[model samples]
Target: MLVLWEIYPWRNVEVKKSVLVVLVVALTLIFPLNVFASVQIQRPVYVEGKRIAFDISPIVEKGTTLVQIRPLYEALGLTLSFDPKTREVKGGNDKYEVVLTLGSDLAKVNGKEHKLELAPRTIKGHTMVPLRFVAESVGNSVYVNTDTKRIFIGVFMTYLKDKYFDMSWGLSKEEVSKINKNDHNELLYENNKFLFYDTEFSLASKKNMVPANKIYSFEGNKLSGAIVKFNSSDDFDEQYSTYTQVIYDLNNLYRTSSIYPYDKYWIEGDSIERAYREVYKDDRMKMYEMAVRSGDLVFICPFDFADTELALFLQNKGTFSKPEYEVSIMYEQNKEFFNQISN
Candidate 1:
């Protein structure tokens, strides 16, 4: 009985150990360790107030937001290319390029290597990349809302300025009003829907006095689009030369595609003359038009399709010449809105 009592202590210890093991196993079954892992399911992503309808929902892992590479790239007007042999994805616009490799935590922005918190991986045949790392790397702004589970990617607006005037998209009405009031050398025209500023500065010869005018179209209280007009003398050949040079300069500054044989109709005395024209496409400009008149050359560029309705209204109001020389440049991201206004 004495021997049994001494051995009983060892037996009690074994029983306690077994209970501890069993409790651990049971607790593990109740709540797996993976439950504590930082993994979030699909969430919504927005770009410039527009929702991106991605085929694969973005996931959050290890405190990083991972998104499908293609949809987000194309949504932001950036071109994306993948090399199967290298397993590398390259995306960029005219100004920046981002490079990412599958299962790599390192990314390159314009040849500068940047460390990523989580490596990009292929999920269900889609390449998922860290959104914030790639976005900010290319000079875009990335914002995440935890409570709403929404991610926002913002592209900055292009601003064009000169001695006479400064212009950009998304400008406030008050800002436009202030500019209009301050500038005395230019004639300013404003209404509830549009603001037209004619700059006294001219690119023409001294005899021509061809003024440059800027038009700003508004939606609610925000600027939606802008146009800079350079009125030329009544010389079609000279106009054609100036147009070619401007198009060449614009194409050099931006990535463009040329659409040839653009047909135009003009009334000549008793009949309409059909003329074929060519236009350079700049999809990054959102929507743009170059209208040529007897003494006017108009360059209309919109920052967003939210101004499409206003643009069509201005066209109907005869603010510019007939739509003969108009070429609208729209990106695929604005296809739905373009179609809505086009029809």
Candidate 2:
């Protein structure tokens, strides 16, 4: 039967077609391995300061901002009730009625007029009030603890701004916490403004955030604040890409742990890159001066300032000059290296 079938030319063609179909399917199942090799992992946002460094990843909760609501009458040992039909909240035996209108940044407390920065709303069938102003009106306090990941509400007196404590450099967590708990009541200031940062978030990895506080708040000539952390996800590769996303949302630089510990770069193997045309400053002193004049924070890798990258690039372009002797000599060497590497 097989020999007879082979005699039919159509049979040979049909058998070959079946074999080709099986091979194609088999290869299709196995061919994705090499194509997936270039896949990358997203980088994580890192918060770094003079005294603190930590990677902000594996976030328990992820949001740019957080808001919490507090009930006033209930905390004061008084009865409270809300009427969904009327959009009214009643407190205590006095029947003090507080009316909150949805979609408007205003409220009426005890039949008198009141206002809010954000409006009240009904969530999960319960009337929710604006957090900040409402709580203040009713004599309660709310605090956001970034380290413990909690929103605290009680008869709290210490405002987040009042906890103007500094994280000292190179101190252990225990030392920093002790200071925070102390009644020192010191007002840390910089650039003629009161410094503000989340202490709990700062002290999460390290027991103490004094150094970080100091760096973040107490700049000699320039001031810096906690803009945001940068990270990549399983969805993307490259730290800069993650940073771009963060900047879009927060409009600030993403802090990282990448430290340029040394000021020198080896000329032999390092890739030569040109200076950014729109540099904010010419040299470290100039950077300091510019920062003072502008009061802006400047980002620097150790090599950009320490090595001859800036000087060499500047000399080749002849756009600016620096006063440092090492810069001029190194620029000469760097210029020679750049020419040699290109050829």
Candidate 3:
């Protein structure tokens, strides 16, 4: 049995109002005396399949492991007794009584003496003991896998993040084959719009996909990213068609970045300039850098402007018909994806 004592502060609030044409209100806050609380209970251990998820949310008991002790204890048929006065525990069977201090690492089995490989400690005032030592000492097998971050007890496997997608987890050979084939569709559209800007990147493992853009990683076999083309400098109506066409493949853009070369002379304060400045502040730089470093095909949006300064900056010939402009450092040719997308 385990017992814990806790104390907490309490605050009281009171509000008073006077009845009149103009009412007066009074509020009083009071601090109450702190009280100590104690409780006694049998030890508990929670067993999940090779993985255990610890709830570290509550400040009172955060990071405390809710253990499952029955299977391990019953396997050895160990009888346990606790002395509340000295906070000591005696367990084992009639054949032996193991004496253990609540907070000490030393234990004596029938007075012969023994050592705890790891001392049992109180977390958030709850006594926690190592499951491995207790189980194995009682003839129950305990296996832990550091590689998979898993623990196995009596054919039960438990692992951290078993219910979540972990990017570092490795894939099996069959999973690798399936991923290489691009058999999943991880992209989803929100608000029925294609040019969304959130990182909801994932693939449905069950979706059928062709092999052109498949990624094989614990992340998933999805398109990691791609260069998309958006040509919209034409007539507004015709440009809309091009925009839709560019966004049609929006579902396939993975880790996408863009390239913009010198084309026409757009004004310094033009929408293109503004868009670029805004995107420069976006912290998704690493994704774009990854795309650029990969040397993937990049999409560009050539700005067509008549501003002389912009013209000189682009080094335009002061002519139309797709005049060649000079790409500036501010407009890195490797990462203009957002600008191209906006265009």
The prediction achieving the highest lDDT against the true structure is 1
When sorted by lDDT, best at the front, the candidate numbers are 1, 3, 2
Candidate 3 residue lDDT tens string, 1-343 = 0000011000011111112232223223222452222222222222332223343211111222223333334445677666789777666765656566665667676676677754454445444555555554443444332222223444111111211111112234343333323223333221211111112222233143212111221113221111111212323233333332322332131111112221222332256544544755564433222222232212222221110000001122212444322111111111122232224
List TM-score per model, in order: 0.39, 0.24, 0.25
TM-score-best of 1 and 3: 1
* lDDT tens per residue, model 2, 223-341: 21211111112221222222233223211221221233112222222232122213533454444333222312222221111001111101111112321111110100122222322
- Taking the tens digit of each residue's C-alpha lDDT, what string does model 1 give over 65-124? 778888888778889898989889999999999899987778888998988898787766
Better of 2 and 3 by TM-score: 3
Best by TM-score: 1
Q: How much lDDT does each candidate structure score?
A: 0.50, 0.28, 0.30
Error of 1 at 210 (Å): 36
Off by over 4 Å in 2: 1-73, 76-78, 83-85, 92-97, 157-343
